[model samples]
Target: MSNTSRDAVLARIRQGLAAGPAPLPPRPDFAAPVHPPLNNPDIVVAFAESFQRVGGEFYYCESLEQLAVQLAAFQERQQVGPPYVWESDLQAVLQAAGIEFLADEADFIANADLSLTSCEALVARTGSVLVSAATESGRRLSIYPDQHLVLARPSQVVAEIGDALRVMQERYGAQQLPSMVSLTTGPSRTADIEKTLVLGAHGPRRIALFLLEEEENNG
Candidate 1:
């Protein structure tokens, strides 16, 4: 409270600092993984389990036809208007399947209900999808819609989050990294309201991932 007492406190603090900085706390092994391996062997299975546990819909498509059928059913069941798709790759698949989509930049969000987008990679360990602003899907198309439908191949699935980051770097490292690189684990949810859980409070109410098998692409 007194100036003298304050000066003494400051002097003591300076003396302690002069003695040398306090030893740092024991540091963790930076090289080691923060999380243990899932050890599930089947990365795809690991992904499905973690994803569904958090209210994500996991669909395994043996063939493109099956993917189309399931996607159409999801569209019809939810009664969401035509999905918004931007990427040419996804557009080709949709066209082949005869699934109509809204890709016009001006009208894409006019009546958006379902958003079908491609992802960078799938993190099997965390059930997360790595998305970026660099792609045609951009950002809002995946988050603003009532339902988000990700179209990915099994080959894109990786063992951990680090692997997903690696993929992001490898793809866009030459160019500046995308303005946004997001790892979305599941549908948006919040329990901040009196501890009562609510889904889709901020984003999509439903999140579905369809992993098309590699062989299907050969055919």
Candidate 2:
């Protein structure tokens, strides 16, 4: 570079350095919600509507008996074989209802047609289910198989993601948060191939959630 050009560049550099650093941004209000407010009066209803809109099957069961009936009908309608269930509580309930499932690990690995498990919480606004490593369902049951089923109660429904997060915080203290926390809003889908949307490209093609109302006696 010529001496005159070098001097000009050096002068601009010095001028820029003369100005002080930019002011720091204002601190955010962590207590206040950052996203759009979720104003649903009934989170369970909101969750069910949103979940179905996202191509998920939602069953609102007033009792365990109703859940069993609805689930059996769903299975028959879909023509899917026995589901893979691992949770002891879910297994017991299904067993009592005469609903058959494959609980063997080898069977799951060999034939993972559908998986049934419990979730931590359900987000109403986005119709997402929050699962953590703390929950047994957070394992392969949530992501593997062609279809995924979740069993939860109305008490676990929250108005929004933030509310669901607070529920988790209360469930597992800060120091003991799960290693893997995920929110599943719908079935796995991608539009990467020829810009045409494809379901179950990488994960379950179908998703189902059963919300069982808490029994009055239990509450």
Candidate 3:
């Protein structure tokens, strides 16, 4: 009886297939509207506002020299000693400014008062910094430190997440993607304990972004 029922079901399926392909529904018209690309000035403003709203601090530096000055001030204010840093152009700047940084070692991240690293891209729409395992900082450096400082250039800022992903794809290609990617919007926080909000519960209590803007030449 089971065999007979199976045969009947198969026969019905075959009959339906023999009836030719079913007609597809008509495609919708009404062309989707396209949003204009955000200008650099607007993108900068939006990113700063969004980032600050989430308890993050934003600083604008006109050049590498300005960045160095800001970092010196920040280090003094936070009283951080030998911040943890990965290999990047910022290292030279930090060194020139006499700002000592711990060697890029996993074990030193927890003891360091602050961690400094470069980000992949800055999302203007959400004010998130995208980082990947391919970077020297790896996956643990950003979260383990008490304070996180990101060094980003103005050219790295994008309008949205899709734009940031596209930048990554263009930079590394799809075939050779990083092991992991993280989009951090702000310092870690939680309200799980008795509904009282707390910062640094899971990660850094303070997150600061320093954006370096280069002066363009008309000549």
Of the candidates shown, which would achieve the greatest lDDT relative to the real structure?
1
lDDT tens readout by residue for model 1, 13-48: 999999997899998899997888785888988888
Query: In candidate 2, what are the lDDT values of residues 155-186, reduced to their tens digit?
Result: 89888888888888898987788988889989
> How displaced is residue 75 in candidate 1, in Å?
1.6
> Which numbered prediction scores highest in TM-score against the true structure?
1
Residue runs of model 3 more than 4 Å from their true location after superposition: 1-41, 96-98, 104-110, 215-219
1 or 3, greater by lDDT = 1
Q: What value of lDDT does candidate 3 attain over all alpha carbons?
A: 0.82
Window of ten residues with lowest summed lDDT in model 3: 32-41
Candidate 1 residue pairs that clash: none
Please list the C-alpha lDDT of all candidates, in the order they appear.
Answer: 0.85, 0.84, 0.82
Tens digits of per-residue lDDT for model 3, 18-110: 999999999866585355454446787878887887788899987656777788889889887767887677677677556677776756834
TM-score of 3: 0.76
Model 2: what TM-score?
0.79
Clashes of each: 0, 0, 0
